[model samples]
Target: MEPAGRFITFEGIDGAGKSSHIDTLAAAFRRLGETVTVTREPGGTPLAEKIRALLLNDAMDALTESLLVFAGRRDHLRCVIEPALARGEVVLCDRFTDATFAYQGGGRGFDAKVLSILERITQSGIALEPEKMRDPDLTIWFDLPPEMAAARLADARAPDRFESQPAEFFGRVRQGYAERASAAPQRFVRLDAGQPRDAVWSQLTGSLVQRGWLQAGTSDVGASAS
Candidate 1:
């Protein structure tokens, strides 16, 4: 059987505004009396965090990047994600393997076939069964045009390695996300992050309620988050 908890992932190219709504959603889930574990990829655990620093600051080849990412993912699974999951807490993760496939495989033009192998090797055994791979029950993808993304990022902060990439790279990353969504529509929902903040929050909360993860009409943004 699957874990008693649900695993949800948020995805988008940087500056697409996906991160803006994660905490609000987490609060909404908490209001519904669920135990929520909100975390991010490449930095969920100590080792993973160190890897995240290197990934965002240091330059490396695609293959090396892939290996480091998967290495971090393995530790994150064992030390953070899977455990929270096993304890029946909802896991709201910011990015996951899909980002790896997008950033490394598509953005960096790495080998997709090898990514497949790495995905399998890194994600298997989630159910304590070697063949069973872990995946989000729902993936909320914030779809925004690359041009808008660039404009949004322009004054946000000092750019990191991935954030500083050219518009062309973001386009490829967006395409990669689209491909992943296309291949798994049942597990994915596309959100227009370009929408007004309240509208986006409504859609997000509504999605969880529709899936029975949250009670209907419990859509108020918590005091702290609102």
Candidate 2:
């Protein structure tokens, strides 16, 4: 079936201020009569959420961590993501394989080759032909300095495993995300997270509207986009 839905993902390190914008974007799409399914990685499905708990709190080797999240990803795909797309609903995922690559491969210094192989095996087909690997149509990356990100999280809720990583590790993860964005420039939009909150939202919403996913006036914020 031709998937009519759009798959967009919001990504960034902890405290890049990505979490606050997703639902608001979903609402904008809904205003345009689009059905938007907002979900998150390593935790979209029940089983995936179980895996998320382990990955977040437990200490394990990087390889083990990668395997668990991929397993969760597979389930999340089959159970939640794919179905929503099949029904023509926009999927707004908080994170996906990129996060795994960032946290495990980049942060933990795991083998990227292994992550690539796992990604191929696990995500070969979902909303597309069986031979094609599915990817988000658009990825909005809030690029923030690791130091500033750490500062944002200072008094926030307690961090999970990845969130608690040192500045050096986050620096690596940021680079990892940069590498991914570089590899797929068309699919990625990098936002300077240091900008004022209004500016960040302007960029984020403008991205969607600019892509023609939403009408010109789609974003009350991105109306500035026109």
In terms of TM-score, which candidate is strongest?
1
Candidate 2 error regions (>4 Å): 221-226
lDDT tens digits by residue: candidate 2, 136-179: 88899999999999999999999998889899999999999999
Scored by Cα lDDT, where does model 2 land? 0.87
lDDT of 1 by residue, 26-80 (tens): 8877877889999999889999999999999998999999999999999999998
* Distance from true location, Cα of 41 in model 2, Å: 1.1
**RMSD in Å for candidate 1, one decimal?**
1.5
Task: State the lDDT at 10 in candidate 2.
Answer: 85
Please estimate how well model 1 matches the true structure, expressed as its whole-model Cα lDDT.
Answer: 0.88
- Candidate 1 has which clashing residue pairs, if any? none
Most accurate candidate by lDDT: 1
Clashes of 1: 0
Candidate 2, residue 149: how far the Cα is off, in Å: 0.6
